[model samples]
Each structure stands twice: as structure tokens, then as C-alpha cells.
Target: MLKLDDANIEAICGQAAQLPSPSLPEVAVIGRSNVGKSSLLNAVLGKRGLLRVSQEPGRTREVIFIRVGTRGYVVDLPGYGFARVPLSVKHAWGRLVEAYLARRARGVMLLLLDIRREEPSPGDMQMVDWFRHYERRFSVVLTKADQIPRGRWKSASDGIARALGLDKDNPPFIVSVKSKEGIDSIRRLLTQGLMAE
Candidate 1:
């Protein structure tokens, strides 16, 4: 089991050039703006108020790299879609994210989706396509699971997976920051990635 108690922010990069050199495996968290990426991360790392959570979307304008234990990192990519920022700024974010992803062949991505949303947005589809195009390792994680009834989880996850062109039987990870559900599973996944040699 990989320990996350020692995890700490390692770097905040606004551009690809500033990204830390790849030394260990990374688990990259990604999602649309206001999808609860920060909250999920905080829960997984067992640290409250570690990653700044903002009511306003698009507050995370840069890629944040966090060192986890002595073996790996957890990367926070800027959220896409539904941000109130200018078009130019969004474009810049897209470019920077693209650059970072293009270079991280060894990294695994956790693509988050709001559990309440019935359909995957255009931005979500684009991200899925990008990951497939590059043959990168990625997993879908449904956030805010506590907002919906527990009985609806199965159906909701299946619906989202179908929308994203993924297997319904193997639905995405259903998570809730409030309930701390599925946080340990995500942590285990990241731990496995880090432990792999």
C-alpha cells in the first residue's frame, strides 16, 4: 500500500516548459470545471484544504503536481468547459494541458464526470478521444455520487459509460467527497501505479 500522508504540492506549472521532469509514475486528475476534482483529490489524499476549492469555476488555471510518498505524483490538470474565463485564456489552458499530456506517456488519467449529469459533454468526449488517440491509460470517475440516491448509482454510472462509449458492465468509479465513498479505491489505484516498476 502506498502512503499518502506525506503527499505535498511539488510544483505548479502554467506552461509545459515549467512542468517537472518525469521521474516517477503519475496519476493525473481531470474533469470539467466545477466537477469536484479538487474535493475528490483532497479526500483521496486525506488532507482537507490541500487543494484550493473554489465556488467559482476555472480557478485552477495551471497544472499542479503533488508528490506522493517517495514513489509517485498526483497531477491536477485544469478543468475544461463551463469556465467563465476569456476565450484566449481557455485556449491557453488547452494548449498547456495538451502539451503536458503529450509528454506524459507513463501517466494514468482519472477523467471525472459529474454523477448528476445525464450525458457526457462535448469537452468530455473530446478528452476521451484524445486519450484514445494517444493510447494513454485513463479511467472514468463519476464525482458527486452522494447527491444521488445509492440505488441510482448503478444506472447512472452505466448511462454515463454508455454515453462515453465505454463498457456499461465496467462502469466508472462512483465517488463522493462528502461520503468518502470510493476514495480508498482511487487511492489504491494510484498506489498500484506508483508501485509498478
Candidate 2:
């Protein structure tokens, strides 16, 4: 993957209500904690540690931004399903995500799923449905591609599509931070998605 220049970041909100205006096309990365979302972001940008990686889930707590050139911005949201975090915190995060999605006029969410885990959690489904309800343009991505066997990937991807209500026409891309698969396609799709509007 080609190196991406360091993105200029600005803190948008402590709570979602305080989020910055949707002045630029924004793409949000969402998933359960430890689903390789941070790793994927770093890998795609050819930078290490741009987004923090945590063994324990729910380490990220805020809606953060990384400017993607002059045309767009990449938003990293707090992860869901971190068992150790307080219920209050989880609820707050949920509200934050919901509000940000609702208010951001130019949001193009990228939902990340784990390939080894074939199905979405109830929370994941809620998020998907939320995006659908808001009529947001989005796509689902399966991360950690290299961990699964090559032959099994087809079945795993198929299962994910079925479970997520995605059709054959709109299948998820299997990606790996370790092997760098599907990074280019994501970059292209993101570029096109952001530039189109």
C-alpha cells in the first residue's frame, strides 16, 4: 500500500451533540472492539499506530477524526461490545454513535466485521439497521482475512452476507492487515465515495 500523509485531526465533540459540522465528506469505521478496525486504518494508510490498538475491548471512547486530504475525513468511532466497560459508558457511546450518524450529512459508514466470526451481534444488526433507517450510503467489510483458510473464506464471506442481509450483488470484501489484502479496493472505493458527492 502507498503511504498516506499524516492526517490533520481536530477534536469534534465530547458528546455527539457537539460534533463538528459535516463540512467535508466523512467515512466512519465501525465494529466491535478488537475487530482490527484500528489495524486496518493504520495498514491502509501505511502508518503504524495512527489509531490505537487494544487487546482489551472498548479502549476508544470518543468520535475521532483524521483528515483524508483536502476532500474528505476519516472518523474512528468508539467500539461496541467491550465487556469490561461500564454499562453507562456503553450507553453513552451508543448515543454518541447514533447522534453522529444522524447529524452527519455526508457520512459514509464502513462497517467492519470479523471474518472468523460469521454473524453480527445484536448490536451490530442494530447499527446496520440504524444506517439503513437514516438512508446512509455504507458498505460492510470483513477484517482479519489472513487468519482464516483460503477455502473457508468463501464460506465465511457467504455466511456473513446471508446473516447481514447483503445480497450476492453487494458482498463484503475480505481484508487483512497482516497480508494487506483488499486495502487498495477500500482506498479506491473511499476515494470514489467521497469524491462523488
Candidate 3:
């Protein structure tokens, strides 16, 4: 029953200094390119055009700040790997992401991985390591859940957790934007702060 139609983006910034004062709690969506970050954001907002869906990977070049009903913020970051951009630009994305992850206070990171993927990518692993090292509160979300059969969801979630070195009890959230499964759970986690998963 959670509704995100009230979501609105307050600011968009690439540099840490340009970020807004962050008057509300924040949740960030991050992952490799083409991982459905945009789709998930659009679904959460209950609007399709809120986030531009691009076929090209690495299209989001800056950090986008989407404010939700005067309550909190949902930040969407640029994807990490295999963007058809110059080396300099790629490094810039890294710096922007690193700075945000390290400095954002009272923020929970939603680390997204495709449910269809069994093995965590190198970039995904590195991100998890960074989160652990910084003691940041984060949860993994396995997107594209509809790609796999419903009966296999548990096995897939467990496999992904093991691959990421997370305890079996700490499996990533399995969600499918198409089927509307697990969307409410994500909403609660975002607005309520780490509810029982």
C-alpha cells in the first residue's frame, strides 16, 4: 500500500559540495550499468517518465537527488562498469561515487544486482567491500526477479548471498518490477529504515 507518487527530485549534483543540505533521510540506488536502476526508481515513484530510461549503459552521468514527499530522498548514482565513455569520465564517476558513499550521513545504500546473475561481478564485490570498510548501512537488492521462475527465487537469493560472502540469513531482497513483487518491502526499507526483510 506504500505510494511514492509524491516523490520529487530536489537537486542533482555531480560533486559533493554541490549536493543539497539533505534535510531528509536518504536512500541511494547503485550498481553496474544497465542494471535497472532507472526502472526501479521509476517503479518506486509510481511514474514512468520520472527517470529517463536509456538503452545505452552509463547514460546517467551525474548524481540525481529525488526527494520523496518532504520525508526523505532517493539518490540515483551513475553505474560503475562498462560505459562507452572516455577513461577520464569513467574516473570522474568513480570519484563522485566514492565521495558520496563516504560522506552521505544518515543514508542507507541499496546495492542492486540482477536476480538472473548468480556470480557477483568484480565491481559489485568491490562496492560491498567499501561499504563494509566504511561501516555504512546497506542492503542488497536482487532486481529482475521475474526473469527467474518463482520456485527458484530462494535458491537464487541464497546463491547470490554466498557469492557475495553475506550470511544466508542476510540474503539480498528479490524484487521484480514487472510482477510488483517485493516492491513494497523496498519502500518500507527506504522510508521506515531497515524493516524486517
Candidate 4:
């Protein structure tokens, strides 16, 4: 797998059903609001400010599709946890996201989690369970790893691993957008060449 020809990337749509016909492979980025999902995505695409980053949580209110290179897309899904919206809005968001997750045949999910948090939220755990039940392809990414001291990165990752029942030695991809640590590995995974593999 090689890096994407990111220069050709373009947004498909802000809504799921409105996505351009599945002309390419699709990868979805999902996590709690403010988990730095957008930041991580920018790093992966080598495009700062391409996707909207907001100080406000839940600012991303739609399913955004970005065509990457010539064969695939990087999907930016609206954040789930702690969006601070009304219950009705949240439920609506759930329905919207569910449609995409359950129906997108070429979709893979990149589940992001905050590394500094004590444990995965109940909602996050439930999503994992759902993925297992449906046999969905997904990957975990621990975001904001730079917040903790470099010496304690492993301990922090291991703690999260233990809490989430992940392999302590093979914890989720831990990364820090601020420091650009662990971004290359993710970029490789996201690159068009690797997606073909």
C-alpha cells in the first residue's frame, strides 16, 4: 500500500444517502465529540483545515464523504458521545448514522477514543458490541496521546487496553495530532495503495 494521491481529494456530500455512487472504497471516522477525529483525519490526509474543526463539540452535524486519490474515500461521520443536543436530535443522529453503518457495503469504521479518558464510554462499548454482532470491520485509535508525558504513553495505552478488554501489548493505535506522533502508521493504513491490499 502506498500513500494516497491526496491532492485530488474532494467532498462527496454531507448526508449519507446523498453520497456519490459507491465508486470507491470508503472508510468512516467515528468517535465521541471532541475526540479529535477531525484533527486525526486532517493528519491522515495531509490536509489541515480540510474538514471542519470546531471548539464546540458535535459541530459536525452531517455525514461527510471525501474522495481520496482515485479509488477510495475517507468518511467523516458526526461524533456520537457528549454532543449536548436534545434527546430527539440525538436519536435522529443515531438513525442517520445507523443507516450508513448498517448499509454501506464498502465501509470500514475507524473508531477513535480519547486516550486521556479513564475508560471507554458506555456508548462506545455498545458500539463495539454492535460491530461484533454485525461482523463489521473496525479499528480502534487512541487520540490525543501527547496530552500525557511521553514516558507514560504505554501505561496510558495499557490502562485503556485493560479497561476496554484490548490486548495490553497491542492496544489501539495511539496517536497525537499535536505532536504528529503515530500519524504515519495511520496514514499508511489510510493510503489508497494499502486499501487495495
Candidate 5:
């Protein structure tokens, strides 16, 4: 799998209706705010700051699209679990996200989770349920795996899968940007998903 060395970010779509007609297959990166979504993108692409890494949660208001390769597109969706932000702003973003998920063409979605924890909040579960309802192809990937002891990887992944109602046979991968774990697997998965007809 080729690492993202020169992935070029395309346009930032403010509204789902305004999304440019894309020819390539798209893979959406989604997770709670500060779940290392930006960092993970940078790591996968081997480019720092490709996606804006913001300390302030919910800084990414737009849905940014980038070309990963000849046939693949990477979509950085706005983080939805941010708190302490204005309710009006949150509501607007939420509506936009929902519309996109509901209307966009089918594609693969990588839902990120922090490796340190197993259980996610209600909002997280809602996202998973939404994907399931739409019959969308999705996978769970636990980021920051280096933070947890090596022995705990399986247990943590299993717990998360069970909590999310995912089958034990399809558990989330334990990945770490620093350790380079699961990078190859993720790239392969993305490549396959993009190539599938």
C-alpha cells in the first residue's frame, strides 16, 4: 500500500448539496472531536497538517475532500461530538452532516475510536446506528493504540465491538500513528474498497 505522500486536498463543501461531482471512490473519516482523526490522516498520508489539527474542537465546519490516489478520495467530515460550542452552530452542522450521510452515494466509512476507552457516548452509538440503517459499508478503527498496554489491545477492541453491536469476528483494529500499527491494513482496505465495482 502506498502511503499518502502528496495527497492534495480539493474543495471544502459547506453544504451537502454543494458537494462537487466526484468521479473517484470516496472514503469518509469520521469520529468524535479530538479522537485523533486529523492526526491519523496526516500519518496515513505521511504529511503533517494535511487536515487541520485544531486544539479547539469543532473547528472544522466544512466537509473537506482530498484525492488520495488515482482512484481514491479521502473525505474529512466535521467532528460531531464537540461540546461547549454554540447550540445553534451545532444544530446547523448536525443537520448538514445528517443530510450528507443520508443522501451521498454509498462508500466506505472509517469510524475512529480512541484506544484508551471502550464505551462511547450516545452520540457515537447514534452514528454507528445511522450507518447501519443506511446499509453503508463501515469499519471501526481504534486510534492511539500505543497509549494502551500491548496486552490490552484485544480486550479493548472486543469491548468496543460489543458495545457498538459489531460482531466479534469483525472487531476494530488497534492502530497507532507513532507505532505504525494497522497503517498497512487500513491502506489495503481503502484501496480495495476504492477498486471494488
Candidate 6:
């Protein structure tokens, strides 16, 4: 199993040129603004306050690369949609993220969705489309699973999968940082996937 206890920041890139060279396998975490990406990272890595969590959206304006010992990296990409930032800044972020995704085609992508949201946002659908277009390895992760009743999880998962044009039988991972639900599974999945790469 891959260990994440030794994870450390490797680089913070504002532009594509500054992104670290693809020296190791990587898993990129992506979601809309304030969708609990930072919280999920902290929980999965077994570290608190490692990645800054902000009440305000769009605080993560750059690509953050974190190296996990000698194994690989867990990349934190800027969140898309529902940020209060200016239009120009949002566009810049989009371009930077596009550049990073295009360059790191070999990396795995974990696209998070808020479990409470009944439908996938436009931004979420766009990401799914992009991943499919590039034939990239990606998975959907539903955050804040604790907010909803456990009994409804299956139906919710199936609904979101259908909305995203994914196979309903293969539901997305449902996680909650507070309850520690599915965190270990995600960690193990990332470990196995990155190791195979």
C-alpha cells in the first residue's frame, strides 16, 4: 500500500511553465469552488491544516503539487465555477488548469461533486467532457456524504452518474471528512492506481 504520511508540498505553479516536470505519477483533485477539496485532501493525507481551507471560494488560484515520499504526487488544482473572483481571473485560472491537464495526460483525476447538490453543475459536466475527450483516467468523488441520509446514497449516486453520462452501476466514491467515510478507500485507490502507472 502507498503511504501518504510523508506527503509534502513540491511546487505551487501559477502558470503551465512553472509546473513541475512529470517526474512521478500524480493524482489530481478537482472540484467546484468550496466543494471541500482541501478538507478531503487533509483527511486523506492524515494531516490537519496542511492545505489551507478557506470559507471564501477560489482561494486556491494555482496548481499545488505535493510529493508523497518517493512514490508520487497528489496535485490540487484550482476549483472551477461559483468563485467570486473577476471574470478575467477566472479565465486565467481556466487557461492554467487546461494547460496543466493537457500536459499531465498520464495523471489520474478525481473530480469531486457536492453530495447535497441534486444535479451536476455546468462546470462539472464540462470537466467530465474534457476528461472523456482526452481519454484521461478520472473518477467522480461525492463530498459531504454525511450531510445526507445513508439510505439515499445509492439513489443520489446513481442520479449524479446518469447526469454525467457515467455508468450507473459504477457509482462514484462518497466521502465525508468529518465522518471519515471513504477516505481510506480513496487513498488506497490512488495508491494502487499511481503505482500501476
Candidate 4 vs candidate 6: the lDDT winner is: 6
Worst ten-residue run, lDDT, model 6?
98-107
- Extract clashing residue pairs from model 3: none
- What does the lDDT read for residue 133 in candidate 6? 74
lDDT of 4 by residue, 1-197 (tens): 54554634366444546645555677778888989988888887888878889889987878877777566778788888774579987887777677677664465677888888878898788777766666667778889988888887777777767776764454588899998999987877676322643
TM-score of 2: 0.93
* Residue pairs with clashing backbones, model 6: none
4 or 6: which has the higher TM-score? Answer: 6
Across 1-197, the per-residue lDDT of candidate 1 in tens digits comes to 77887889989999878987788888999999999988888888988988999989987888999898888888888999974678988788878888877885476899999999999999999999888877777889999988999999999888888888886454599899898899889988888777756
**Candidate 4 TM-score to native:** 0.86
Q: Candidate 3 versus the native: TM-score?
A: 0.90
- Model 2, backbone clash pairs (residues 3+ apart or across chains), number: 0
Models ranked on TM-score: 6, 1, 2, 5, 3, 4
| Per-residue lDDT of 115 in model 4 | 84
TM agreement with the true structure for every prediction: 0.95, 0.93, 0.90, 0.86, 0.91, 0.95
lDDT of 2 by residue, 59-84 (tens): 67888888877777778888888778
> All models: lDDT?
0.87, 0.80, 0.81, 0.74, 0.80, 0.86
For model 6 the local lDDT of residue 12 reads 92
Higher lDDT: candidate 5 or 6? 6
Report how far residue 143 has shifted in candidate 3, in Å.
0.8
